[model samples]
Target chain A: MSESLIPAETLERVGEVLSGPVTTVIDRREAQRYAYAVGDENPIYFDEVAAQAAGYRTLVAPPTYVTHAVVQPRTAADLRTDGLYREGTRIRLLVDRVMFGGEEWDFLEPVCVGDEITATVRLAAVDQKEGRKGPFVRQVRETTFVNQFGDEVARSRMIGIAR
Target chain B: MSTDTDTAAAAPDLATLEAGQELPPMHKFPDEAQLFLYSAASHNPHRIHYDREYARFEGHDDIIVHGPLQGAWLTQFVTDWAGPAARLLGVTWQNRASGLPGEELVFSGTVTSVDAETGVVELEIAEHTSDGRLLMPATARVRLPTT
Candidate 1:
């Protein structure tokens, strides 16, 4: 049997910490940019008047907008190089090729503009899989987002396939 | 406020949607520039998304689209049909195949179930190529307005 791509030591630390508890303020401009990037024409995400009509205090983010906060930096100059798959010691020790497998997100509440969102991320699980080409590792990172008031905004499970 | 009127006008009529109803299909042909914008907006610095040479070295014909980009399109699929009043409760999706840049991907969904009392509906959503190859298969739960 061929050896797995990820080391056993790395696999042993499945539940180890990967990134943050990183906090980011969800700006309306960023939200709109994300919406535009996805080609979403929803006025609630772009126009304040439309958002007000939708019963949001201000512009509401698109459903996947929270994802941007998951990867974005806290500040323009805060170069804290810590994130899932971002120069982390454990990630660096893993396999060579990495691909985004998929993800599942549950929205508990709408994340509106000006909401200070904090994300607590952890390496949830790791497993070795037999791919057609060779052996690969599947890593799942779970991130929980909350508002400044401590409201649970959303929970996500992102899976990455590395070989 | 006019927002209220617009909200009311934009709300999806829950009574009009039924189980097995197919939502309108959204066609997307994301080019390199659009993919770059998506990567930029999400702050993803993955080289495979931009550097064609690196992507080729990694064994892909062209730049690969971000999985989250597909997820975003699926979210739009539901929201566009449900309107602003509808709340997207959750979505679970898997990327079965790689989506190449400039490929015509069709996003579509089917109403699996609807609960009148809770005003929540379940949908089976998917993204496919123009020739009908499924790239991503997903399920979503959305809360619709009862009133």
Candidate 2:
């Protein structure tokens, strides 16, 4: 087995809320753009009557969109060398490369246009494990989305694999 | 007023829906334009998704499709088939391999379980290339409208 990829400080970050609670209103135009970009023109996203017919209060955002809905804007000066924006806080890690592992989402309530949504990201877990290639680190970032009514609308867990 | 899909079709009847049933497959043909639009819509500035040369520098075959885009497709696969009335409860997907541009990606699924009492249905789903390369393995749960 190789050396530990997760340091003591990093492992201790488990269950800590890493990013601040970002609140944003679900915008109709932005949500529609996302739906159109995905090529999913589900009428419930475009037609109000159709959304109500489907038991939603109004036009609905696509499933899993709540995570994207709350992304706070960043300035161009914050661009990283890789073209991705620099995050406010960086998680320390000892790894050569990190890869996107997977994502899990739970939609508890309908996320509709014009709804105010607040999201907070937590470092759910971090651990080093033995893989076929030797040793790697598995980290999970869990984000919870709550609506204006104080109802938890959705939750997402994004897994990152580093070696 | 863009052309809409048959997403407005009737929701599945929980009474008749059973385990072992197969969902009709959905196909996607993503191009550079689609990728650009998605990047803009999602506010992602990841160069691997846009700069082909940079992507190759990063050791990718080509400007590969975004993992989250494929994930969105997985949700679309279930929701489009289950119809607009079906409430998507949860979805999970693993990123296995990269999907390149112009590849015909197919999404297929089988009903893993069904709860008649609560109108809940579970599915085992996947996305594959036309040449049979597995890109993502996924699962989802949805609540259908009762009869």
Candidate 3:
């Protein structure tokens, strides 16, 4: 994790794009699937006809539907060998022994099916501190979602806790 | 009911709930079906969310719930308590543990502070197991109708 933690003086270097811009296309089927998963039956998310009647040009996604756009079809082996963890530790940051600290999302536009959205994720901030538990790393990641038209759709700030 | 109304009406418009005051509990038991739908929805294909075998390989006991799902449940719970017209000014949550299927997750909220003139309610909300294992803890500010 120390490798990913840029020095306080070099924090500006972290903003440089470190990887490819992954493009995720949100379709109507996926939108409805996410809506049903949360048990939210809002017609704007489920029925295309209803959504159109409600003034949406096409079926739009729920407010929090962007969580599904970043997962790529990859194996744990790939993540493990590829150094998924900044250093090389098998700490289940997103699953076990970790926590979803908080999130802040700003929606600038709506997402519909066939909209090829690209997420440009960059490491925003990383800090370490000593607490009652032990030493831990708090990483803040920022991802901006833009559609094929190059219009910014949404931006998310994700806080991850790794111990 | 008359006494209850009188007390509510006389409570200085913004009654601050004490620490022990009961904030009605909301029950949510997310089944595998719901999990699948959520996995499909979020586009998060982390095997731990759906594949029991993959989850086991990754050291999880079962398909774990999504962090956002827990947060959304809490948001919905608070919204329901605050009523439909109450606009959500802001919400923040910290996930301390993972919730699995069949666990009796309860959503509860309490008024931590209030602004009488502004008619805003500061809430200390939480989602936890029936056994009191906290899953998601959050704070929210909502504007309530003064009337």
Candidate 4:
């Protein structure tokens, strides 16, 4: 086994809330913008009548747009050299480069425009794994989204790999 | 239930839908404008997404498409066929390779399992460049309404 790159403190942070209990009301324009951006142009996201005809209560957001809707605004000054916002709680790792590994999502309930949604991100896991390339650290940030009715609307696990 | 942009796809007919059936392929031609719009919409200000020189300096062929943007396409690929009435139970994707702009990305899938009573369908799906390079290998589960 490779020498442990994950510090004890980092490992200890597992299960801790890394970001928001931030809440935002799903907006029609914003959701539509996202759909249009993705070139989705799905009727359920555009036409209310079509959405209703398709069994939706109203125009609905795309499956993964809710995650973007909850992003807390940051000023350009907060941007790092990479043009990405400086996150509040940075997970320390011995490695320097980090790459997006993958994403897993569970959509339990439909998220519609005008619905209040709150998102909370937790450090689900951080561990060292031996990969074909070398020893790498796999970190999972789990975000759970809840609707105004207190229903768990969706869950997302974003995995990051750093070596 | 496989539908692309030109054709309006509906939910799968449980009686006729079976395992080993292939979903109609969906094609996406991602270009600079689409990537830019996605960056703006997602609030991703990463220079690599917008700056070509910076991307090259960082060791990439060109300014690349956002992983999440392709992810949205993957979901759209499934949802368009599932129809609005069908609820997406879950979906997962692995970022295997970077997708550059102006590339034709194709999304295809095979029905792996179907639960008739509960109306849940499992799919093994993937996003590949038209050149046959795999970008993202994925899986999705959707619950189709009986009605």
Candidate 5:
């Protein structure tokens, strides 16, 4: 196996909640925009009347809409300093190129348009593996989303490959 | 509205779907502009999505499609099959290969298993290019209406 660029000590920080929990209200316009952007034509996501008929209190957000809301937008300073990796807390690694591996999501409840959602993110796991290209670090980040009532709405685990 | 009725009509009934039933194929041709919109909406600043030259520099033939965008299409495929009343329990996907702009991707699936007592069904899903190159391999579990 190729040696990992990230130091062993740094990789030890895996499974820690890097940043604090972030909370944001699900905006109707933003939810609609995301749905349209993804080419989802589900009426429940677009029409309030259709959502009500389907037993939702209001227009429902798409199943993956939480992804767009979980991470807060980066500020000007964050952009200047960290570049585009501001979705979560930064991990000190020696490698430069990073790519998204894949994602797994568990939906417990439907997200509505006006629900205030909070996402608590943690580095779930980390490992060094010999990939086709070379030795790379695979990091799994878990984000638990809950509604204003503190009910678990969804859980997302995203994997990133760094080389 | 008529559109809502049309969508509802398109949903598959639980009684009709068997273990080997195949979902209707969904064809998607996402162009460069759609990719840009997805990047903007997702706050993804990765130049590989919008910058063709940068993407080429990164070793891709053209701007590559986002994995999450492919996930979205898969979600729609299952949900469209299950209808609005069905609950999507979970989804897992792996980005096996890269997809480029304007490539005609066909999403299709086969019912792997069905649990009558629990009203649950499992599906093996995949998206492939027109030439049969697999792009994304996925699986999903959904709960159909008991009644």
Candidate 6:
């Protein structure tokens, strides 16, 4: 956790909220576009007919596609105001600093088109380290993906480093 | 839209390429359309990805691409080069720099070592900008199918 933007209390709070599920509906265009964006060109992701022929009734998303579902605000102030960070924060604790570090995910099932999925995130761990770059904070977040009716789909372990 | 037939390299393909042989080129350009597509595919609603104004306020010049999108592309680059007979047991990478809009990226690597008995080859691969900045660096182990 970064001491600047995220306080221990804030981290705790964020952890609490991450326990429950947050739902978002999948849109067709977005799904297809995402597949194209990744340069996957995998028909199972872009064409419903192709996906059906491949044994899926609906178009499926690439295994790592869930990263696009959560939208972050434009401003640091907004992040704080929305309770994304601690009050009067300057540095972001999520994604390591204020940006992306890295991520890893495992797909248990495909996220088919028209599936209303919910993701339940958990703060797995946070550790501080001193490296050649500088002081760094590593945070691990675990998220479980599920469909509308609550069937588990997959799990992701994302690690972010803060400078 | 690459078919398996397109990837039908001969068995022991790695045997043909020298230890330091360069992998085939894979291109990536940070564009608005690509950003939006990545966001939609990844279900990532992160505004910094497709919203320049939002990204500016967040300290980025333009929308940033999702890190995973880069990773996925990196995976594809390796899998595509490994050919149809190669089974990708695992592909992973660490993001060193963020990829923003309009930056040209190319994925390239060299064969580091090969284990013939196991049919596995180790590679040191990275995604680099046109200016030669490293974005994501990773090691990949590919196991080729034997008949």
Worst 10 residues of 5 chain A by lDDT: A78-87
lDDT of 4 by residue, A16-111 (tens): 999989999999999999998998888899999999998888999999999999988888999988789988999999997999999999998899
Residues forming the 10-long window of minimal summed lDDT in candidate 1 chain B: B1-10
Ranking by TM-score: 4, 2, 5, 1, 3, 6
Q: Which docking band does candidate 6 fall into?
A: acceptable
Report lDDT per candidate.
Answer: 0.81, 0.88, 0.65, 0.91, 0.83, 0.66
Off by over 4 Å in 1: A1-12, A70-86, A91-97, A128-136, B1-12
DockQ for model 1 equals 0.44
* Stretches > 4 Å off in candidate 4: B1-10
lDDT of 6 by residue, B85-123 (tens): 454544557878788777778788888888777787878
Model 4's DockQ?
0.64
- Which of the CAPRI classes, incorrect, acceptable, medium or high, describes model 3? acceptable
For residues A9-125, what per-residue lDDT tens digits would candidate 6 score against the true structure?
Answer: 545644543544667677777766766667767656666787777556588765556546543224555443212434332324533444456765555556777888888777776
- With candidate 4 superimposed using the best TM-score fit, by how many Å does residue B102's alpha carbon deviate from the native? 1.0
DockQ, per-model, please? 0.44, 0.64, 0.26, 0.64, 0.49, 0.32
Task: Answer with 3 or 6, whichever has the higher lDDT.
Answer: 6
Worst 10 residues of 6 chain A by lDDT: A81-90
TM-score winner = 4
Q: How well does candidate 1 score on lDDT at residue B47?
A: 75
Please report, as a residue range, the 10-residue window in candidate 2 chain A with the lowest summed lDDT.
A1-10
lDDT by residue (tens digit), candidate 4, B1-147: 112454555667988899999888898888888878999999899998999999999999999999999889889988888877788999999999999988888899999999999999999999999899999999999988875
Model 3, total clashes:
3
Model 2, docking class = medium
Note each model's CA RMSD in angstroms.
5.2, 2.2, 7.6, 2.1, 3.5, 6.4
- The list of candidate 5 runs beyond 4 A from truth reads A1-6, A80-83, A86-88, A92-97, A130-136, B1-9
TM-score of 3: 0.66
